[model samples]
Target: MYIDLHNHYLPAVDDGVLKIEETLLGLKLAIKEKVSTICFTPHIWSGRYNNSPEKLKEVFEKVKEEAKDIKIKLFLGSEVYYSSTIAEDFSKGLYLPLGEKKKFLLVEFASAVMPQGVSDGLYKLMLEGCEPIIAHPERYSYVQKDYECLFDFAKAQIPMQVTTQAIMGMLGRRAHRTAVKLLDEGLVSFIASDAHSPEERPLLFREAVRFLNRRYGYQTAKRLAIDNPKRILEGKSLLPVAGRKGKYSPFQ
Candidate 1:
């Protein structure tokens, strides 16, 4: 079963689904893509979205109840926007983990600039026994300016996720090129459908998986689409890719 670690299908939470019908449509598309488990990751940006964990849980329960007959398991998480006080917020339970294991937290960086003290915050989270999964590193402007920053992140043992749409080149040429580079460099830990709605950013897991399998190989595709994500959910160490040591592997 494929596990989607980053998605926004919950109704009226953030910039994801605005209504119950849209949420159900997104779920149907995910099901068609052979997704068995999905994590509904709403944006948790302070001073903007401000999605509290308690409120997220309440919305998740409602979505779960509505999606009861879909045969897909739903999990609650947050695509936490990175801030200077992230480590403190995480300790205060301001963000949700990837799954019930509570080992990995899905995080996003600012689009305009890399936030101050992000590296230190990530290191602190690691020291506190929490793995930080950087969501869609390919979309960030600084990393686009310097791809070597991704290597630095890898050296710091920070794992990354690339959106399926980015890989498929739907977002734009630059994002597509960056995603390909990250995958080729063995820096990406997961490939997820950051699906927000059916009309705009729908789930493209099946196409993305096929592309990975054809371009890279079956094992590489499986590692990003399945194995690594499962490991994250199970709170186990991810397998090494491209012969890298300790850190999660990408394509070999």
Candidate 2:
């Protein structure tokens, strides 16, 4: 069993699943991959998604009610797009933390650029008692060009989640390369599905774990996919990963 801390399975709220049926199908599919727990993190972007915590909660409750018999645990949260006012917004209940613990916030940045003062903003969020989990840093253009930016995040003690698709080379080559590099450097704290639809971004949790086990060893794979994510839900500190040495080969 593993925990998927980021996903867009919540229906009709964002660019994810559009219907309750899709949500159910996604959950069923996730279960098939041995995903025992999931956090329904819908997008909470500023202009694009603009989903409110209350609205998301309402939708999540309905989804929980519908999927109660699916033999999987479900929780509610949001993939908050970065903003300068994140701390203030979180205080006003404008954002939802992962698992509602009010401790960890799953955050994403622009795909093309790393915003100015984002590190400062994330630091301020940490000061306000929310540890930011940088979601899919491998997919960022800036990081793809120079993954060393993630060193700053690691130095700040910020955790990161690399999506299963990126590791599987389904997103793109740069993403796959960066994701593997992050893992090699022991910078990634979690591995999540980030699944959007049952067909498009289906949950590949088991496959990712299998791949990681074969490539990086089983303990490392389990740490990212299971142990660390469980720590987030429990409001505990994440374990530090011991990075593997040597350059990464795609087919290795």
Candidate 3:
């Protein structure tokens, strides 16, 4: 089983599923994908998503209740867009962190540009004892242009979550290439569905696990798809997943 740490399955929360039915459908599909856990991370961007943290939690609770029959774990969280006031906003409890302990925060930058003060902003969050996980660095245009741009983040010990579609080459070539590079260089810490709808994006956990198992070996796939994500929920340090075929030893 796998724990998917990033997804937007809550209806009317953001740009995800619109109805509760779709939410239920997505969860059922996730089961077929071998996902046993999921963290619902709705977008918390100003003006665009603009979802209030409280509202998100309320909807999350309702969805949890509705999906009680489903055999999977669901968590409440938000994918906050990077902004100059992000630290302050986080302090104000405007963003929901991952899992119950509220230690890991999932953050995203604009798809077209990696903000100038991104490193400084993440550093500030770290200083506050909040572990930040960059969402989909592989999808960033800047990162696509220069994959090495992630070196600073890597050195800072910040974790990153790559989308499953990008890893499966369902996205464009640029995104696929960048995702593979990130995994190949050991910069990716988690592989999530980043699923939005039931069909358009849907869940791809099984596909990703299969693809990664073949491309990077079974242990590497397990680390990103299972172990690392479980650590985030438990508020534990993530184990390193250096991507090299036939190099990683089997988990004992």
Predicted candidate 2 versus true structure: per-residue lDDT over 81-174, tens digit per residue: 9988887887787989987465899999989988889988988888888889999999999999998877778777888899999999999999
Ranking by lDDT: 3, 2, 1
Across 1-252, the per-residue lDDT of candidate 1 in tens digits comes to: 788999888889898889998988888878888998998899999999989999999988988889899888888888999887888888889999988798999999987688887889888877768899999988988888888876656887777899999989998888898888887777887799899888799889999989887777778888889999989888888875541223234332
Clashing pairs in 2: none
Instruction: State the number of backbone clashes in model 3.
Output: 0
* Candidate 2, run of 10 with poorest lDDT: 243-252
TM-score (C-alpha, index-matched) for candidate 2: 0.95
TM-score of each: 0.94, 0.95, 0.96
RMSD of each: 2.7, 3.4, 2.7
| TM-score-sorted candidate list, best first | 3, 2, 1
Per-residue lDDT tens digits for candidate 3, residues 1-252, read 899889889899788899999999999988888899989999999999989988998898899999999999999888999998888888888998998788999999988977989889988888878899999998999999998888788888889999999988888999999998888777788898888898999778888888888888878889999999999998998888867554422221
- Candidate lDDT scores, in order, read 0.85, 0.88, 0.88
Misplaced by over 4 Å in model 2 are 245-252
